[model samples]
Target: MFKAYFTDGGNPSDLVQLARIAESVGLDRQRAEAILASDEFTREVRQEEQLWLSRGVSSVPTVVFNGQYAVTGGQPVEAFVGAIRQIMSEAKGGTVS
Candidate 1:
C-alpha cells in the first residue's frame, strides 16, 4: 500500500490496486482483495481519517500517542524520543515538566 501510494501514485480509492499492493507486501492477495472489495477495513480507515481530520490534522505522518497527544509532520529523532517519554510518563501518572 505504501509503495502503491508513494511510488506508483495509485489512489487509495482503487481497490484492485490496493489489493495488489498488499500482495506485494507479502500479505494474502486473495484475502486482501476480498477485504478491500468489502466494506470492512475501509469504513474503519475512513472513520479514523475523519477522527484525525476533526482534530485539525491536515497532513500525513501524524503520530498520535494513546489517542491523547499527537505530533504532526516528519519530526526529528529527539522529538520522537521526547514524545515517547512524555507519553510513557503520563501513562505512569507523571508529568513532562
Candidate 2:
C-alpha cells in the first residue's frame, strides 16, 4: 500500500480507496471502512504519536535499538546492520568502537 501510494501516486488519504485496498488484501471492507470513518483511527493516531513522543521520536523512519540507540531518517542498510551488531556486542559485555 505504501509502495503504491508513494511510487504510483496513489492517494492513501482517500479512506474509501484505502478501504478497498484493505479488502483486496483480505481484510473485511466494511470493517476497514468503519474503522477509517470512526474516530477510533484518530484516537489511534494520537496514541501512536504520544508513544513516539515519549520515546523522544519526532520524525518518521526511526529505527531504535534497546531504547537507547537509534538511526533516525534515511540510512543505508549497513548502518542498520552496524546498529544491530553494536547492540549485540554490548549485550555480550563487549565494546563497540
Candidate 3:
C-alpha cells in the first residue's frame, strides 16, 4: 500500500487502486473490492483509529514495545535493538536507565 500510494502515484482512497494493490499482495481481488466498496470492517477501523488517537498517536511509524516504550519515526535497526533490550531489562526488574 505504501509503495502504491507513495511511489506508484496510486490514490489510497480509490477502491479500484486499493483492490489492485490487494491483488498484488496475493489477496482475492474480488473480495478486496467488495469489502472496499461496502462498509465491511468500517466500525473496527474507526474503533482502532479512536483507540490510537486516545493514546496520543498523532503520527505514523510509531512503534510501541510492550505497550510502554514508543519508538517513533523511521528509526535505525540499532534503535529497535536498544528498545527491545531496554524492555527486556525492565521486565527483569533491572535498574531504569
- Write model 2 residue lDDT over 1-97, tens digit each, in one string: 8775888788988998899889989999999999988887787799878987887898778987886788888999999988888898889899766
In model 2, the Cα lDDT at residue 45 comes to: 91
Output the lDDT of residue 87, model 1: 86
Collision pairs in model 3: none
lDDT of 2: 0.86
How would you order the candidates by lDDT, starting with the best? 3, 2, 1
Query: Model 2: residues >4 Å from true position, as ranges?
Result: 66-69, 95-97
Per-residue lDDT of 44 in model 1: 85
> Residue by residue across 1-97, what tens digits does model 3's lDDT show?
9998789888889988889889989999999989988898999999998987788777889998776578889999999988888888888889545
Specify the highest-lDDT model's number.
3
User: Which ranges in model 1 have alpha carbons more than 4 Å from their true place?
Assistant: 7-14, 35-42, 95-97
What local distance difference test score does each model get? Answer: 0.84, 0.86, 0.87
The candidate that achieves the highest TM-score relative to the unseen native structure: 3
The C-alpha TM-scores of every prediction are 0.64, 0.80, 0.82
Report the number of backbone clashes for model 3. Answer: 0
lDDT of 1 by residue, 4-49 (tens): 7789788989888877778878999999978866787877899988
Residue 32's lDDT in candidate 3: 96
